[model samples]
Target: MPRSKRVTIADIARLAGVSPGAVSFALNGRPGVSEETRQRILAIADQHEWRPSSTARALVGSRAGVVGFAVNRPARTLGTEAFFTDLIAGVQSSLAQHRIGLQLVVVPDIGEEVDTYRRWRRSNQVDGVLMLDPRVDDPRPALLRSLALPGIVLGGSPSGPDDSATIWLDDAQAAHTVFDYLVGLGHRHIVYLSGPAEFEHVRLRSEVLAGLAERGVTGETIITDYSPTEVATTMRTLLSRQDRPTAIVFDNDVMAIAGLRVSQEMGVAVPTQLSLASFDDSVVTGLMHPSITCLTRDTFGFGEKAAEYLLDVIASEERLPDRTGPRPHLTVRESTAPPPA
Candidate 1:
């Protein structure tokens, strides 16, 4: 004969000739069921090899056993960017220790990201969330609070006192390091090839560049979507000018490589004529022909810390204070040198 179907409380109740409530009480070791009924229910449950369902556990205010990470970036960009991959790996490493899972999603804009959070909460799909790339007036923090969701805002400063804990890096100090290094190298005319202007880090870096004007440095800003095609087009325009900048700093390594390729095509010798640097570092930065100079940080460690914080908040049901995260340090390579005399 074939094995019997797996038994639920209802099935066990029918087989034992008792009500479902009585079976539930017996199975759970609650008081209402007699010793005789409890023994029979246990035998039937064991015979059917019944196990608790995770979904059922969630509906009863128990953990869903997973956390969420939703990023508001173009899907194509995430495919090319190494920053997120490293960060996510760190998060997974920490989560693995606690036998937790991560659910990552990519959305086109903030609106969709907010909707995702709502859906996750309604279905009890995630225990908490991890937010990234905070904007100047970001609403996600408040939204997370409104939904009673525990979250950590990574790579950004706290927007409000009552908002979720923020894991912030000092963008201003990092930008100053790059700017002062270029100035020390005798590059008076510099250009900042930036990412979207709405990003708080981009705004902070631009502010740092603007302050250089007092020191008699000519700093210009050009914003892009961090796409190679747009970066190359902008690079071509910059290199075509007679008064081209002596050095250009990019927001990411991919953009730096795009600009470097454009410079080579335009017959501009790197370091000898124009110096190139980037804010984010990856293996490609070091493997490039001249090796782009960049800011290096432990992105993986950052992800791990974010995961740790969110999990702690979820477990304790308490709000944690904002924290300062690691800042990127300058890594000089062959791409940067004294401006052409």
Candidate 2:
């Protein structure tokens, strides 16, 4: 047979001297076919190098053996962000176990992300999706529900009536852990450098700073684009302040590293005059001169669990309860200590 030519169930059935229904039953692991007949049909299928076509699977409302994952962020950022890279690797690991394909895409913004989902559903492009970075009044959840699409929210709580399940991290609790650690070190004033305020996780972490006054701790949260240059600039301004914060917490490891460089340039000694920490950690965190303190969690496991949960939702065809993943823990390092007396 010409390699360009396609093989179908009928072709396999004819070659195996069996009916097409028997071929279907054997291929799908149904009980209608005898064991001997099933083995013969399988041998023919293997000989022809036959595989189910995605188009045919979609048309028949069967498993496409694929899922969609979209990120509404700049492509350049994804390249430098270890968090996403680890998460994606974890997702791939779980998907590989079941031999499922992952369709990954990066869109300019949320609007385009929604458009992509709509198109995918209309064309039966995927059996499900994994949603990330939930925003205020996010339209993706309700849209997924309306389209009768199964999905899993990666980091935020689901809004509106959606059959989608959620895998969430306790951002507020993590923030408190950082605060307690810093405050216990006699750092009365702290600064929180965060990502865009629109992100639900960022908002949760920011909100925790509002109540710090009750404990005689002065706190300030500065929102930024999470770029190195921006973080450096913010650090310059903060370091120049008459009453600079004794400790600073960053939403990501990249920003913390940038802030550390700025501190060094300003003749400030880390953990002696200033301290730095990050909400997320990576191998880079440990490689730094002072080995910056940070909150550590299994980002890869997060993605793996997400893939498993979303697959389950698709298979069950029902809404499931939200799942809370492991909370990040503070890993103290050379970057944090008691404020200089």
Candidate 3:
């Protein structure tokens, strides 16, 4: 005999003598159904094993109750990094309270990540999105502003290009704090190893360090693609020079970890021969034989704030938070020290 047609909510509704709407309410655990009817419809759906489908969405213009979280992080960083793990956890915290779930997508690179957001909205894959790694003059805010779609940006500015209410972190302060912390540690010659040029946060960091360098301090800017072998190769070349940098600040902890390995391989003792710091304070840093010195912004906190802000925007489009004030603070660790005398 041929296999039975794939079960649908309508099938369950027919079997239970209930409306499709009632079936949906029961399946989704919505409040419209009475307890007794809810149990009966759920029992029938369980027997048939009915699941949601976009085809049903066309039948009724409503939500699939799934939200998109589209982030643009380097492929190397995403795989070697644990910062996102905590960030995702923070979002899950808020979502669990509402019984909602996230659909995560990490694109090949920043450009593809932005493009995916546009497609997700057009295809109706999600009701809204959580965008991270905003850049200066990013096109996404403007694109999303014109569409009926709603989302929260997880960076330094605008939740929506037209509106400012989505929660955003203070990147400038985070940058400045990291720079000053290095200077305070007596790092006279410093090199800032950053991620892609398109990332606004890294750009902000470069700009901040440039201003400091203008005052006759040693600050060099080198934005490199993150890779263990690449980072090691770069450090090998940089450290071989007679006038090598005394300290290096990386944009992410994973790269800093590479820097640490490079220093060890070159017989350059950390703190004694090289000092390092990085952003994205992951547990890997602490687990290192010597924990990393980093610009410790609360990624978990940022995630929690971004999720709530997105939910608020979805509820009602609101203004973005102010960017003129203090930014995320810096928490120093063991990875940094003054140049060896």
Candidate 4:
């Protein structure tokens, strides 16, 4: 068999119509080449499956221009999440400007999420990472520090004022805003259908509601694990029982949609029958029949910030990384209204 031609920088440079040095800088994600030229070279490299050679590695090293994302969400949720799709889009959008690739790897299960990061850090497989679905008192941030890994935490630990780059979303405030809206709408009894138990933000959202009840709010709450297929059954149980919640706030879009289905099945009228709101207002919210009232967050922006921060962590040496977005709040739709008399 005739040996396939070895892929080389010259092949890339010739195809991209740039000098070999420019190709090197472009492929390395180094400064000096314009973003336009960098993209051009990358496209040509992709066409040929061209990778940096050992000689190139000897000079520049085998750093793949790829960012890994480790998410704790279940395969079912991850497969359907508009937030993941949009977030990944934003990250890819930002990284593509520099010819960086995105390597999205879902942990086999929640247990594997943290271990994925640990293994990646040890292997030096990615240029950086985007960590999502944070857990309270998460050890990953400290792990990153201990390993001197370069990356960004999305909506997790506040990247220390002196710590590594991290994006901390005010998850408590987001839940509070949505709940307060429902409360003002006369939803005294509220049910919070939460995400996986280990997620920190899910816990925080639940905690905020729990604390609100202690403050003399006229509301009752129930918490449960999330799965779309089972929600109809759960909601039926909740509906049949006395003292059922008048309003529901979901920690995710999937649960909110599930709640809607359950309400329909039990002949419970939306708005008139039950009020609803959820966080992470992605396509599911907008596309649903009643158009779920939900917390308005810039998920795409979150991904962008996560990517930018990771880049900074890899490049910058000064100041705690900071980026801001509009605070997430309630985007009322037809799904929520005062309970029927």
lDDT by candidate, in order shown? 0.85, 0.85, 0.73, 0.73
lDDT tens digits by residue: candidate 2, 155-251: 7444344435788887778888988899988989999999888888888777787788888999999999989999999999999999999999998
lDDT of 2: 0.85
Give every collision pair in model 3.
Answer: 164-319, 164-320, 165-319, 165-320
Model 3: lDDT to the true structure: 0.73
lDDT of 1 at 137: 81
lDDT of 4 by residue, 317-337 (tens): 654555654467778888988
Candidate 1 yields a Cα-based lDDT of 0.85
Say which prediction, candidate 3 or candidate 4, comes out ahead on TM-score. 4
What TM-score, computed on C-alpha atoms, does each candidate reach? 0.82, 0.81, 0.76, 0.77
Worst ten-residue run, lDDT, model 3? 318-327
Which residue ranges in model 4 land beyond 4 Å of their true spot? 1-62, 156-164, 218-223
Collision count for each candidate, in order: 0, 0, 4, 0
**TM-score of the candidate numbered 4?**
0.77
Model 3 per-residue lDDT tens digits across residues 153-233: 666644443643446666667777777877877777889888778888887777888888765677888878766667788
- The regions of model 2 sitting more than 4 angstroms off are 1-61, 156-163
The C-alpha local distance difference test score for the whole of candidate 4 amounts to: 0.73
In candidate 3, stretches whose alpha carbon ends up further than 4 angstroms from where it belongs are 1-61, 74-79, 157-166, 317-328
